[model samples]
Every structure is written in C-alpha cells, then in structure tokens.
Target chain A: MKNVRLNALLAMGLIIVMILSLAAGKVWVSPAAWLGDDLSALIIMELRLPRTVLGAAIGAALGMAGATMQGYLRNPLADPGVFGVSASAALGAVTSLYFGYAVTAWLLPAFALAGAGIGMGLLALLAGRSGSLILFTLAGVILSSLAGSLTSLMISLAPTPFATTEIVTWLMGALTDRSWDDVQLAVPIIAAGMVFLFATGRSLDALTLGEDAARSMGVNISRLQWFAVLGVGLTVGASVAAAGIIGFVGLIVPHLVRPFAGHQPSAVLLPSALAGALLVVGADSIVRILPSVSELRLGIAMSLLGAPFFMALLFKMHRELS
Target chain B: MLLSFENLSLTLRGRKILDTISGQFQPGRVTVILGANGAGKSSLLSCLSGLREPKSGSVTLDDRALLSLNGKKRGRMIGLLPQRPDIHWNVDVRTIVGLGRLPHSGRWGMSAADHDAVARAMEATDCADLAERKAMRLSGGEQGRVLLARVLAGEPQWLLADEPLASLDPAHQFDVLERLKNYAAAGKGVIVVLHDLTQAARFADDIMVMKEGAILAAGPRNEVMTADIMAQAYGVEVQIGTSDTGEPLVVPVRRL
Candidate 1:
C-alpha cells in the first residue's frame, strides 16, 4: 500500500515537473500556444517537447540503473557510472565529435550505444563466470580508467581548437537544442534497459543475506550479474548518448527514495526511477529559469549537487562505523 | 527418503578441502557434524546443500543426481543457513524472512501459502514479535533466530546449517538446538555443523566427526561420542559423563 502511494505520488510529481519544463523555458509557451499552430506551438513541439521527453527518459534510466547496480553489488555507494558504461559512451561521442562524424545527427548516438555494448561485453568477459563482486568492481574501475584515458587522448590529438571545444562542451552535458530525433534514439533503448533491470529485483532482494545465501536460495548468480551489466550498460549508455554524462541521478535518487520505498532493493527500483525523472526534469527547469547568461549544463549541475551529497553520505556511513 | 554422497572430494586452490567420503543421510534424523577448526565439516555441509560442488564424486537425492536438479528445485528441497548472519541491508525482519520464499514465490508475488510459511517460520523461531523491527538492529541471538526463521520459511525438506549457534548465548543455543531437533521430529532432515560437543550429544540423533578433510567417526551418537573418537578428531583429552536426562556430557580436559 505504501509503495503504491509512493509510486503514484512520484508519477504525479514527474508529470508536474515535465509540464513546467515545457512551459518555463526562455520564451514561455502559454496555454494559448499549446493548441494552436503558431510560432510558440512550433517552439513547444520542435524544441521543448523532445528535450523534456529525453530528460525524463534519461533520468529514469540513470535512476533505475543505479538502484539495480547498488542492489546487485550490495553496496550503498554503487552507481551506474561506476560500471564505466557512461564513460565509454562519452568516449564514443567524443570520438564522433572529434572526427566530425557527428555531422549526421544519428552517428554520434550510434557510436555511443556501440561503446556501451562493448563496455558490457568487456565487463562480462573480465568478470567471467566467477560471479565475484570484487572482480566485477575491479573490472568496472579498470574500464572507467581506460575509457577516461582514451577520451583524454582524443581531446589532446584533435587537429583544431573547434573540435576540442566541441568535445569539452558536450562532455559537460546538456539537453540544449536536442530534437525529436534524439528522443526517438534514446527513449526506446532506455525502456528496454529498464525491463532488464526490473528482472533483477527479486534476486537483488535475496542478495541482502549475502551471496552464498542468495545462491542457495536459487538465485543464479552469474545470470543476475549478466542482467545487471546489460541493464546498466544500455541505460547509462543511452543516457550518455542522448544527453552526455549526467552524473549522480542514479546514486542520489535511490538513496532519496529508499527511505520512502523501504530498504528492499526491489521496492526501491520503481520509486527511484520515477523520482529520477522528477529530479532531472525539475533540475532542467531550474537551470532554464535561473538568471544566467547561458543555461547551465545539466551534467555540471548534477555533479555540483552530487559531490556534496556523496560527501554527506560518506560522513553518515563513517558515523555509523565509528 | 535418502540423501547420499559417494566418494566425494573437493580441492580449492590446490588444497584438498574434502577427501573421498561416502555417507547416507535419512529424513527424520538430526545429524550433527563436529570437528576442530579447518576440519571438513563445513565443506561437507556445503556439498550436501549444493552450494559447493565436489570435484570427484556425486551427491544424489532419492536416487537422482543432486546437481542435475534445477536451482529452484534444489533450493525448494534443501535450505541452508550459512555460518554468517550478515544482512547487507537494514530491512525489516519480515522482509528478510520473506526472502526465503524466493524459490517458491512466482513472478507475480508471494502466494497465501508463501505468506503462511513465512509466518510459521517466524513463529517457530520465536521471531514473530520482531517482524517489524530492523534486522540489523537485533541482538546476536535475535539475529540468529531470525536468520534461522529465514531458512525455515522455505519449508525445505532438508536443512543444512553451518555453525547456526555461533555467537549465540547459551539460552539461545539451546533454543536453536531444540528447534532443529523438533524439526527432525516432524519428519524433516536436519544437518548441523557444531563446535559444542555437549549440545551436539544432546541434540543429534546421529553424529559425524571430521578430522583434516576426512571423517574420523560417524554413527549413532552413543557410539560416535566416545572419548577416544573425540580425542582423535579434536586432539583433546576429554571426559565423558551422562546427565540426569540420560544425554552424554562431554568436557575437554586439555589439549593433547
């Protein structure tokens, strides 16, 4: 009953924020513009609608992916970005921008999704059938470092200042000028990834007793690992592909919702996803309404918010330990 | 029905964990395995519960190969209470107990029978009152009982527990032993690994003593609980006495 109420409330919150996102941009589209075929309607449909949809989708993906990773690893600090999929996707987008392949609207996202797929493959290969958490985490760290270094190398090797600037700016991440094409590319993949994540809820719940007990309870540990990798890989990869590396949604949203959703990993998943959408859409609206010369990058905004929250979490854990 | 293992051996990182061993376990009996630290007792239990696979032997349940059974089927048949009662999440006790129903519960959710099993398990372990309490906040003894309840919630035909009484107080130890004995009396198989010989003697219908990856002695508790077997397996000189209730009381005099 509590979960139902929470889900409904979160869903309502997300809708409200999404509508505000559409209406609160630089040139506000009043109710009159929503139904009529005018310049304001054109602005709402062509620009804000797709951006709003992509923001919600990306946020949902990051949030659920974070919840799944945290649950599977049985670590509160686990996040989708920790797997290195988002970094690899960023590297792929950077590669496209560096080489000018992003001239085609679909090429960069395609490259990013491909990068995410390769990241998942490498994770699976490195972790193998051992299903050891230490091995999986180590593999993720290695992948992240490798991707980060490669992206740095690409930036350094760029022939012109323009390419470097473009790469750096995209890396900061935003929904600025994203179109319906971006929405069509990211939303379906995110939805598919969510299905894979939802499949892991029961197994993650069993894992609260630790791995051996979870396995004894009939959770095929290797299968669960595969699901987690694929789920996080696709979702985070697609989000990066659509909006660049938005950080902290996955990490912070689950922590926020866990209090209301209960401690069970399964219970936290849906609420985290909804709250994530609410958070990103709400944050995007705030950035737009804030009196800045240019809109703030969503990625930078999230990191600024997330870094402090991460520190606070560490302190809480430290207090508990001491 | 019978659960039997034949010539079972296991090697981990080039170290032999379990030597070639053969045994048959029957339902309606409480089998206690005893040994010194690093003996093969826990390893044997792991193999029995299908948590660890033996390298050179086969375990069968009612004439079918144990490993051949699907994980859910195997889980439904055998429940394991591991030595560690580590609950990674601070979930409520009922939620933790409900995890035992994972094998039996369908995709839709817990059925009425599943809920009843969880309730009954908590009742059996005397943790029903702690249902709403956070599992991580419980005392060691309370945690032990709640973990036992988690295993019992599965309602498995066979229960394999490793050091279920470790860190538990004497009262809770006796309570757990009594619960295992009562479970066996209800026609289920119960296999436990224990360090306390007196409690093992009081609770176990059959006893298996292990030494350095091999079974040193295994038989009816009266025959296997002799001073010589205890000395051989544990390297300790022991005094054996009978209690007023006619249970064997074993006390270690000194290390050999």
Candidate 2:
C-alpha cells in the first residue's frame, strides 16, 4: 500500500478508536448525549474526553519514541523503555507516592519528569561523545537496572499498606479518571518530544548504512545521538508521568507499520505514531468494557498481550537467523 | 581537481594506524593502494575520504581544507564505500541507492535531479533489474553492486572504496574492478584498497604500496609494479609478468 493511503487508514482507525474510547465505560453514553447540558454530556466532557485525548497523546509519544530508538540503534528489539527513561520516571512517581506528596497531583508528574531528565543526563554523560552503540546500550541497561531496584526498594519500604497499594496500582498504568489537568500537562510535552523524534527520520535513514557510512553521508553522529536522547526522554518521560509505564506500544507499533512504510526507518515514523494511538485507545476501550469488577489496568493489559507478542517475535527472529 | 593529503598521521589506542603519510591523487585516474594487513591502507583511505581526522596533518581538496568543509558539502564532494558495508534494514534496492543523494537532497525530499542521478547510478552498475528486490535478500555480488550504485548516485567528485570486492566471486571481482575503472575514466577521482596484487596491477593507473604505516613505493603502475617492491612491501617472493592482453600480473611465489 502507498504510505499516504496507509497513513490515512491509520488515521481513520485512530478516529474510530478515539470515539469508542469516549463512549465506552461502565455507564454507556451515546454519541447524541455528548452535546446537551445534562449528566451524560457532563460525564462525556468532564471525564471520558480527557482520558481519550490523554491516551492518544501518550500512545503517540511512545510509538514515535520506539520507532526512533529502533532506527537509531538499528536494532528491532529496541524501544523507549530500553533507554531506562521510563523506569526512572516511574521511580520518580513512586518516590512521590511513597512520601505521600502525590496528593497534590502535580508533584508526582513533576518528580517523574525530573527523574527522566536525570536519566537522560546520565545517559548523555555515559554515551554522548563516544557515539558508540554498544556503550549507549550498556549504559541504558545499567540505568534501567538501577532505577528498577530503587523502585522495588521504595515498594518494600512503604510506611502503610494503603500507600503500597496506591503505588502498586499507579505503577500498573491506566488512564482511569484522568482529567483535563492531566491532558493539559502531558499533551504539550509529548507533542514537543514528537517534534524532536520527527526531526531524526532522515538521519535514521542514513544510519541504515552503518555508522561509518552514515558519517560519510553527512550525518553528525553526536548530534543524532543527542536528538535521540532528548526525544525519547521527553516523550517516554511524559507518558510515564501521565499514564505510568505503558510498554510495548513503542516496540510493537513500528514493526506493525514497517511493511506498509516500505521498511524504511524514516517512512515508519508517522504510521507508527498513528497506529500507536489507535492501539492504546482501542485497548483502553476494551479494558473499560470488560465485565470485571474494576476496569483492567492498561499497562497490565498491554504486558499480557505484549509478553506473548514478544515471545512470538523472538521465535520468528530465531527462524530467520537459522 | 586533486584530492591530496600531507603528513597525515593517526594513532588509535596508543597504536599508530597512519604515520605521516603524504600523497596526491589526481582526478580521472584509478589509484590502487596495496598492502599487507595492518599496513594503513584502509586508514589512509579513511583520512582521504574525510571519515577520519589525521592527528596533525591536513587533507585538501583543490587547495581547500577537506576537514573544514561542512559534512554535507564534503559528502557531496567525496563518497566512501566502506569495506563490509551493511544494509541494516529490508529496504528495496532503489531506496538503498537513493540514499546516496542524501547530501544533495533538500528538506522536501528527493528532487527530479536526484531521481535522475539514482537511475543513472543503477544503470551504470547494471542493478536496475534488481531495483525492486530487497537489498538484504540479494546475493553478495548483487549487494556489492547495489552499494556501488549507491555511491555512484551521489555523483561525488571523488570515490574511495576499501576492499569493495572482498566477499564476491572472481567474476564479480572483475565486474567491480571494471566499474571502478570506468568511473575513473569518466573523470572522477577513484581510490581503492586491494589485497590482490595482480588485480591492482591490472586495474590501477597509479599504484601505492604501503608497509608498517608508511608508503614503500608509489608511482605509475608500470614503474611501481615490480618483484622487488612486492618483496619489500609484502615480504613475499613474487614473479611479475604480462598476460596475453599485455596487462601486468604479480604472482606470489613464496614467503620471504
């Protein structure tokens, strides 16, 4: 399929999913009720609209970040979380929850963003000037392990069971009861990060020829590295701040869209973004409509699906290698 | 125009890779660098292509410092086909070849002229029939041709290739050497590093022999392709003779 047509299809799919997200909850609100000044209209406007918008923004951010990472690293297994930004951001949010500072709503996200910034700074310090892929990947692994251990430590040391519950629940990731405040805080940041990721498309295309050839082709390796770090940090950090650690969207979306994009790194970016938004909003809607006591957490839902998909991907790669 | 370097030296990890090498490469000629392993042949090509900066010397293109030129301008002037070039994705051959136009492309994407260049490059390399095939799925020889077409698409004033025929069959090796020779014939500077002495002697307009990070011999091929130079540079007893077509051949007889 033509990239333009594929993009259009993805955009159309996203619009449908967004509408479903705005309407699918415990109490179903028809599209007609979304207009008038009544309880249904209030429900749609006050609650579901913000949640849907936030879901789309977070998904787009993660999707674009994933595509950028995979292209920059030239590894299909790479994702935004591989950079440790998401885990560090989660640690920051957990820290706020552990200290009971999350009651302010803004403090948690602020801490998460701060955590992401520190992770990015550390990454730049470790891998920035060298522009070596192995070094950058190893630094990310170390950062991820460190951040994960710290989060676990915070969980074990929670003062009360209730605090532990809150931290654990938030860490599972969801867009439940998210308001316009969350949307306002995260959307602009994710948009800004997307701009950075978008700028890397051409450079990523150059990188498919390997680092030496890329440099020969006028790609400034250090500059491209900085852009990848900044872009992934902001987008993944903001998504974690707003929606917790949503995994697999970045990893899976690019792969899903690559064939349609002619397998070009630059061509894969936009379609991945759109498909990511579609997947998240669609998944969130399914979780909302499930007949469970409480709505399933989106992060856990993604993991349940993503882990199996990951295994399948590994198997496929094994076959190809053999 | 001349692509020349002066007193170029490079040291990596406390080991000297290039030791104050100086040479001038003329346009419209195929200059082949021959050496043993670790003889700085590849490193010299890296310096000449602006892929590596020499420690304390200069590379100049037409009297302007090569390193001082911006990456895009330098890329437009010189294209390097590295040894073991990898196509990391499953992209088609046309797209792979089109990447050579990156340094000349504008923000909006490939121009009409850029497409023409890509087409011409594919035609020249005889890979137009493989344009729609996935690059990674092609045979080694086909992939090499596609990569060469990629460099040609850039239409740079200088082309430097390091062991471009490494993994190809003998037939494909001749094919690549002929392409390089034709490219130089069309008035672009061509520099290649080759381990095969006979191939170098057959294809090179000028020959440079390097040993232990220094040039052992360099001049017109007829002046430099000698048994004494081969023994000095490669530490091998060699027989230099002419083929039926009157092309020179260097056959290694024994270890020194």
Top of the candidates by DockQ? 1
Q: Write the per-residue lDDT of candidate 1 for residues A211-322, one digit (tens) a residue.
A: 8899888999889887887787788888998899998898899999988888899999999999999999999888888889988999999999998998999899989999
Model 1 Cα displacement at B51 (Å)?
Answer: 2.0
In terms of lDDT, model 1 sits at: 0.89
Please give me the DockQ of candidate 1 compared with the native complex: 0.72
lDDT measured at residue A122 in model 2 versus the true structure, 0 to 100: 83
Give the range of the ten consecutive residues with the poorest summed lDDT in model 1 chain A. Answer: A124-133
Candidate 2 ranges with C-alpha deviation above 4 Å: A99-107, A117-142, A159-162
User: Comparing to the true complex, what docking class would candidate 2 get?
Assistant: medium
lDDT of 1 at A57: 96
lDDT of 2 by residue, A100-187 (tens): 9999977987898788868876876886445566788898889999999999999999999999999888889999999999999899
TM-score for each predicted model, relative to the true structure = 0.96, 0.96
Question: All candidates: CA RMSD in angstroms?
Answer: 2.1, 2.0
Q: What is the lDDT of every predicted structure here? A: 0.89, 0.89
Docking quality level of the chain pair in candidate 1 = medium
